[model samples]
Target: MPDIDDFLRNQERIITTRGWAVTHVLPTDDDPDTTAPFAYTVGLTAHDHPELIIAGLPPLVAHTLLNDLARQVYDKAERFSHGQRISDLIAGYDAVIIDGRPTDDLLPGAAIARYGRLRIRLQQIVWPDQQGRFPWDSGYNFDPHIQPMIAHL
Candidate 1:
């Protein structure tokens, strides 16, 4: 797995080069409860990584935040690069999240759902681990990987 720092840096590069905004939810020191900071949501337009990623959030919440961050990327794509070609961006990433599933997606444990009915809500689970540790090649599973490819509009 790529170090979280590498992943974050890569994402920051993509966001800045593409000129997109990133939104995140964070807690202030004043807030006694650090775990559930959802009472408020923070939206940042800057190109810097938020404290959450650097601080390392709980896995479940981190996954949800990643999803939201990705959605923001897509939304920004639609806003700024609407007609511009994004094939390079699409191709460069090891994977792309489609319909909540990652395609050519190599992120480990990225497809399994911890909060919902994974089998029903998720169609496939793909990751670098399937090909053995440190396998750089992308693998596709019929039920999981194909679902996202087909669902792409």
Candidate 2:
């Protein structure tokens, strides 16, 4: 099984190589260096699930990237989970949070003319103790309002 540190290091490398700026800290309120086209703030939740905040990209791009990143993490967890069960991997952490909002929306009362925002929650699948089995089903659900933004990626 791979260590969490190695997994996270690979994740950071992937994000950087894909041209996304990964930051442990959010930009300070007083700082005025908003030149990056895309930014992702990533941190672990209290229960160990990854919480990701993505900004500056269009809604579709953000959604695609979110899915890609989550898949990457899930893949890593699958390798570490006993019996290669996705359910076991998910059971080890909290819900994965992907919060994607338009950069312009950060402005007070700013009206976004295009691309709706999305906050997706991916929860782990659970089973009854007696009926529990491997190959657990898991998926993500997004706000219905963002349906128009989803397309083949």
Candidate 3:
């Protein structure tokens, strides 16, 4: 199995190579608001604005992390293709109170449900870009030795 650090580094490489910027945050145990050991906020800018924020739980495996990242990127690309604004995508609903109590429990649960579905779909499908190339592929087979190994194997 790959080390978590190595896996995250590879993710960063892939995202950057695809023309998006990634911001990684590693919080210490001393922090009171720490949700996970590692968290990433990815976007196209160097600032705090992020298109996706992923938190890695203690039991979260590498594949899950990768799938979540990939799903978010795919969703972002799809929305962009449809001319959706980033601000519209990231906009949050104002919390409403009924009988002087918050009724926002369903909001978080809905987001989680959406994410769960996305991750499952990501695992089952190889999402292709506008050019019909898989996101993980560089659109070229530059390595001369890989084909020979594939034929032999």
Candidate 4:
């Protein structure tokens, strides 16, 4: 695994050249609290926008989502409000933007290290299942532990 300093340098370089960087994290088996994997953007804070995050997807999927959404948000200067419904991400399923609390467990360490723990803000882009069922909805396909709605938890 890469060291923290290396990670910081990479984020800095990308943020410097591209205005943002994506950080994808997967939990180890020993980590009791982190049951699901997640990804987040690292440099949105520079634009005065809170960092964007998405959990419960594969690393590459999460990375792509973060990158695409971050680009749109930055290029278009679009800001998502809590409880707002977004439809463009998934073909037919609408995603919800939840106000992710900047807690230690929810926010990425890279973002926290750059912006300080509890100082940064995150908006989690929560996607629904294939059936267009959200985590909060009944008959959702994924296992309950796959998508932990940290905002509501």
Index of the highest-lDDT prediction:
4
lDDT of 1 at 70: 42
* Model 4 error, position 53 (Å): 0.8
Per residue, candidate 1 scores C-alpha lDDT tens digits across 70-119 of 45544453222111222232223222222322222221121122122232
Q: What's the lDDT for residue 30 in model 1?
A: 83
Report the poorest 10 consecutive residues by lDDT, candidate 4: 100-109
Give the alpha-carbon lDDT of every model: 0.30, 0.33, 0.30, 0.82
Runs in model 3 deviating more than 4 A are: 1-15, 21-23, 29-38, 45-50, 59-76, 80-153
Alpha carbon deviation, residue 43, candidate 1 (Å):
9.6
lDDT of 1: 0.30
The residue ranges of model 4 lying beyond 4 angstroms of the native Cα positions read 29-34
Model 3 Cα lDDT, one tens digit per residue, 15-48: 5665333333444568644333332233322221
Predicted candidate 2 versus true structure: per-residue lDDT over 9-69, tens digit per residue: 7655654454222332224567545432233323222124333333444545555554555
Candidate 4 or 2, higher lDDT: 4
**What are the TM-scores, per candidate, against the unseen true structure?**
0.20, 0.23, 0.26, 0.88
Q: What residue pairs clash in candidate 4, if any at all? A: none
Model 2 TM-score, all chains together: 0.23
Clashes of each: 1, 0, 0, 0
Rank the candidate models, highest lDDT first: 4, 2, 3, 1
CA lDDT for candidate 2: 0.33
Ranking by TM-score: 4, 3, 2, 1
- Superposed Cα RMSD, model 4: 2.2
